[model samples]
Target: MRLRVHRRGLFGWEPGEDALAGAAVTTTECRNIDLDRMLDPARGNLVIGARLPHMSLVFDRDARGPGHHLIELDDLTTKSFARLDWPTDSTEPFTISQLGPRRL
Candidate 1:
């Protein structure tokens, strides 16, 4: 999956899923995203079996300081996904990193 941000909005495309779709993007002033709280599992447990896909995200030029937006899955034909709001300080710069533990 690849994500691109333009004048219109955020756009994502995944092979074998759908070509591309308009994404809901929100900008907020916050830091430290809790994965469990953002993505609630149907089993009432945070640790549930889910298929995580590879993603490539590109931020907008105006967005700065590790800015993050919550992306929701609304398309039935494509692999839906969501993102938690990330923190960004005015003094700092925007940076994106891959979350989760490393494989040993």
Candidate 2:
């Protein structure tokens, strides 16, 4: 997938064109990612049983983190998915980490 930036940069990765000055920059990105290899069965509740459906696993990029977490089955796509919650006493970052995006 290609990353199209409108402004300078979202996470300071690349320089964006000045839209006000009528300048636009385009960049291309090609990734050969494997969803199966990046999946987390234990935490993601991907166990096959009577309750668990025999379907494909889906993953989404952690918008607020540096990794990706399991979302839901693609066949039954939904925005709402089960998330792992942290303890109230913990001072960790407000983001979940499953598998980091690999550049392979």
Best by lDDT: 1
In candidate 2, residue 31 scores what lDDT? 20
TM-score of each: 0.23, 0.21
Off by over 4 Å in 2: 1-51, 54-57, 68-104
For 34-87, candidate 1 gives per-residue lDDT tens digits of 333433444312222133223222222223234443332222224344333333
The superposed Cα distance between candidate 2 and the true structure at residue 10, in angstroms, equals 31
Query: Cα miss at 31, model 1 (Å)?
Result: 5.0
| Candidate 2 lDDT by residue in tens digits, 1-104 | 31121111232321122321232212222121323333435433334212443223334456335453423221122211222222223344422222112110
What lDDT does the true structure give each of the candidates? 0.30, 0.28
